[model samples]
Target: MAVQTYSGSCHCGNVRFEADIDLAEGSGKCNCSICSKTRNWSVSVKPEGFRLLSDEQATTDYQFNTQSVHWPFCRTCGVRAYGHGDIPEVGGKFVSISVACLDDVTPEQKAALAVRYADGGNNNWWNEPSDAEKQYL
Candidate 1:
């Protein structure tokens, strides 16, 4: 897949970031409580591939479950542009960038994305999002 740089930020622009992403690789949406409530649409980018352009102090953290993921929201705008967490498989941390926050992608680009809905609401992250994939197809 080809690579592209995406710049995004919170609704109020208090929290911002840039990431190198391949939109063809698709993105993720979870049925988890917070996600379901916020309708978060996201793509994963490695630490090196992601850059935060805003002050860390501009955001506030909210966590649940095992507290592995830190859901940061811009205090001023109440928008969660991204989330941070460590992955056991990668032996490192990762950033989940909100696709809706992206400033440059066109609506067509967004519509073309293949999204997988994880059953995170049930803690069944191990299983493939089969039903959701089928629906998209």
Candidate 2:
């Protein structure tokens, strides 16, 4: 209900992390090429609120577009559970956490979450997704 630490990991459990996330603050879906392809529904948190709990060496970073964000995934399982970036739009350092990767979330808790939509595919990072896109996202 409030900001609390949540455990998350990549599919193979090779990359693990903990983040202080407040679901009431909301989560989001981005209609960008990468996000759309991966279906990366996420929550944004300050970098200080995220901590890597496993081997960093077990993961690899993938960057594209302006190359401002580091999308890290488990090398073994290829699941991108979280990423970090320093972007002005988010007040400097931020960690983008994959909601699907969270370990202990309940169906009720997930249903209670507010969902924000972004039209990232058109380079509109903070705008709403198109109606047609919304249905799928």
Candidate 3:
């Protein structure tokens, strides 16, 4: 799919954002602790493709392990709307938009998109894990 702008928000609607994403580029799931726990399904986009449509102070950030990624969520609803980090593999600064939080994307559209799995639990960002490992991720 071509790049398109998507609007999204947290459960309480206190945190809202917009991002331009191309689902054909694929979304990702990671076995990293936070991702696994949150069941984060996301797509990456350059910082320019993302916009915070609400007050930045309405969100809170959480960082762990390497503390490289900043996961921001709505303070009122505790829904992780998106995350930001510097990943050389993805150019430089990038935003990881939560696919599930997208308000305009239908379930059918999300199901049809390609998904990639990462073995972030083991710190292997560049390698795809075994099929068996992917099952649980």
Best by the lDDT measure: 2
Query: TM-score per candidate, in order?
Result: 0.88, 0.95, 0.93
The TM-score of predicted model 1 comes to 0.88
The superposed Cα distance between candidate 2 and the true structure at residue 24, in angstroms, equals 0.5
Residues 53-75 of candidate 3: C-alpha lDDT, one tens digit per residue: 99999988899877889998888
How do the candidates rank by TM-score, highest first? Answer: 2, 3, 1
lDDT of 2 by residue, 88-137 (tens): 87689899999999998777888888899999899898799888998887
Ranking by lDDT: 2, 3, 1
After superposition, which runs of candidate 3 have C-alpha atoms over 4 Å from their true positions?
Answer: none
**Which structure is stronger by lDDT: 2 or 3?**
2
Global lDDT of each candidate: 0.85, 0.90, 0.89
Question: The CA-based lDDT of model 3 is what?
Answer: 0.89
Best by TM-score: 2
Model 1 per-residue lDDT tens digits across residues 12-110: 999988999999989988777887788888888888889999999999999997898899899999999999899786457888999999999899999
